[model samples]
Target chain A: MSTDTVETIRTTVPVGAQYAPGSLLDWSEALVPGDIVLDERVAPNAPWSAVVRAGDVLTIVDVGGNQSADCLMFNAHDTSERYSVPDTLTWQGNAYVREGTVLRSGLGRPLMTVVGNEIDRQDTIGGACSKESNTLRYGHHTAYQHGCRENFLAEASRHGLTSRDLVSNLNWFMNVPVEADGALGIVDGLSAPGRRVAIRADMDVLVIVSNCPQMNNPCNEFNPTPLRMIVTRNEDTVR
Target chain B: MVGARDTASVLAARADARAQGSNVSDWMPYLPAASSPFAPEGVDPSALVWAETVAPGGYTHKVVARGTRLRLEDVTGDACAHVLVFNALEPWERLNVADTQKIPWQAYLGAGHPLLSGEGRVLATVVADTSAHHDAFCGTSSDEWNVVKYGDAAPQGPSPSGRALLTLAGVKHGLTPRDLPPSVSFFQGVRVEDDGALAWQGSAGPGTYVDLVAEMPLIVLVANVPHPLDPRTDYVVGPLRVHAWRGDPSGPADEHYSASPERERAYLNTTDYLEARGL
Candidate 1:
């Protein structure tokens, strides 16, 4: 006689179609590999937004090159089990994340796996945005601007997730070239319009995204462009 | 089960350190600053550089160096550079903004400022300043903090400019959300509308960079750029290099000065103090 309300529901989205603009999706139906979503170029440094469920495909299409998409990720099941770039790299044993790399959770579990790549995928080592970043990086006057954190919390709230669920994420479509002296250089992007990478979920995952509106950084070349996502499920699987 | 085991071990280690007052510094081995795997392909192998570029999202990499100056270049001008620092030997150690703000280190991060460790050691020194000044009051913010500050508001996404420097520093130092302290962002590009209207403007030019000289054997993790957003489903990102770097010529020994446990503890205590005050 547990009085706790355990709500189990299923919502389905078609593949190759645009995600309804400004719509909040249920965690049960959002994140799936092969699902293509799109974001028309946002103003520079605007908050990026998105959501995903377990076992879904997620893709970001760089309609134009040099658009810095400031992004973030978190676990739906447990916020503490956030994304760890070092662990992911150590686990993968490679610096560049391409097809077939598994995204590890904070606890070092496989949250999802990268299954496809249209363009050379970007790095996850870089994290998402926040107001403080906005202010310090930009100027004191820009502190009040909207950012990825706000988008994540907003979508996560619908699914009973909270700040604790917020985790570090991967930066897709960005290009940063490293040098031998251990110095990092933000370079132009390798992604182009219609190019994409796909991810397959490993478990029931709650995925959140912020369409990076950052103008600073060469990853996007300061031009925040729109992106598209497409989600598809395996045939014969009723979701 | 294996993941759980690792989590348990990490939790146990954290708890044990807290209860026994066991210094994590003693357990941590000093590593070369340029020794991280996060270094991108094709750089001077001898130099321990942290990041070559920062992807738009939250990403990190490590660079090991000794006596080498680390540069965070805004390949494009007006790039907001959110940078953090730490002692590589004790990955848990980090820079204390409050202590950093004290006296010589305040308002600007340049030559002569001691980069504090989680254990309160002088990990590095700000040897140069290419930008206007080093930001002491602001550090990288967690998603949770951002939400608390702004309700249902979107963030200014990721900064590709030199944003990766922060990520690389975090990863190299083994820092987690709990370890996040005040960071400094350089070469930001945003347009504020008259009467509070906002416009996105490209602020940085190609090749605007910041340089930092390592004081200890510290790992430099930088996620110069932010991750891309999937408008519908949140994507689980794979490992990608935000930027690449070459190690400094001087070598790891030249960059770091050895320290005692007492000094390490003082450094650690300072970071703790700052966190307690929400700096």
Candidate 2:
């Protein structure tokens, strides 16, 4: 919450720096007006879930490049039916979800499909952190710090849901790769400022998101930042 | 199986860690340890503990004593019980995956493996596993999947989701979403190939089962469903039967302990804590 803590959110990389977020500025800069239904800015480490109707679109903007947006989805009509990581990978025949990939539910149905992506690939295997995990991975000092689990709990409670509803999540703009030795690494993201991903609701669905607050891993570069959620429809004409 | 020298080191390390504020590092050696297994003096599940069948789209949570043997048997094939465990006395201590894999150097959970807590304490051990390859990493089914695959919307033949069921059960225990940690999916199968890719497979058969013996008092939760990766087209998977009973105190060495020195050390650490507290 402090300026010093915020400063750690992102340290500008010089042009052509090894992982300088390249060309992400184009999406944010080139974006024109569309019928905006909902415009919300999520804080550095907050959880937000909403219903996105079929034919509607949800655009996630990385206001701060490298911020990881951990997400989970369910059929708005049936909370029991939710996202399936294995089906998405198996159906797409790929591990890392990317542009044009369909986000499948557990029964192998499409809940939403990625129509746009500024980040190259999203993480499905690497999971969100919790107080217990923070204590386990970083140390006891971090146990008191906020995490996605807490964010999800605070947000999900408003919907009458609890831990049983939590599942594997999608990490947009986060870079986690399985290594040659089969070891998993949470590395610094290739996403730059203004980089974004857009998903079209294939059916009415619930989208829950946690602007990850993890500072221990490279995913956020040890600094978490805010994100923007833009819900829009193609039929809505700009006034 | 814990050697005398091992017990001494466990005590010394724990004391040293406490003095230096140990939860800050990979103080695996200094993590909380369990006492000897709890052996129910005289308790019958059908009478004292618990015996119940979880129908489709349902789950349950209960606190049972150490030495409790949790028998999970699927009435039909392709059943999954997503489970999470916590130390009943100290709720803050819950299962931790990072240590489970790194400590025993096991990438895949198998019979004779200890389910670890954040502090590297033992939560449960897979003493018996008839379903050889239960999913260790993949999670459970969800709402969108149920609708997409079965056209069952919520509030009707609502899709079956282990996550949702777990939550409904968690509320009864006063556990919140923060307590909903990653779980061990039972009765499912997933295999990692030589190319570093993961493959999804179905369960063994009806009646396939696994038994978990708690090494300490445990708050256990179960989600009755199939793995999210289950290639079933139907939303309805299968029913599961859970039977809890007391275990043998003088039972042979912990399966995991006898299997490896690392695991034996883990048990020793648990014993050190129990002994120090004089439990």
* Candidate 1 segments whose C-alpha is farther than 4 A from its true place: A1-53, A134-146, A153-165, A236-239, B1-279
- Ten consecutive residues with minimal summed lDDT in candidate 2 chain A? A14-23
Clashes of 2: 17
Task: Assess candidate 2 and give its TM-score to the true structure.
Answer: 0.59
DockQ class, candidate 1: incorrect
Task: Give the candidate number with the greatest lDDT.
Answer: 2
How far is B79's C-alpha from truth in model 1 (Å)?
38
Error of 2 at B110 (Å): 3.2
Provide the lowest-lDDT 10-residue window in model 2 chain B: B27-36
lDDT of 2 by residue, B1-279 (tens): 145323357777676557766333211111121211222224342333656666666676789887888877776875678888888877667776545654455545667878877553677888888787676555555555556556653522556566567666766778765466556788777665544456776778887778888888889988777576667666656777776776742133545565755466556555655567665
Fold similarity of candidate 2's chain A to the true chain A, as a TM-score: 0.84
Candidate 1, A1-239: lDDT as tens digits: 11123353554521111222332221122233332343233333334444455656665555555454545455655555555543455345444567887776534467777877756656653455445344433444554555555666676677665554454456777654433322233467786655666676576555555566554455555545555555566543223
Candidate 1: TM-score, chain B only: 0.49
> How well is each residue in A35-100 modelled by candidate 2, as lDDT tens digits?
677778776677888998887889998876888898988888887677766557655645677888
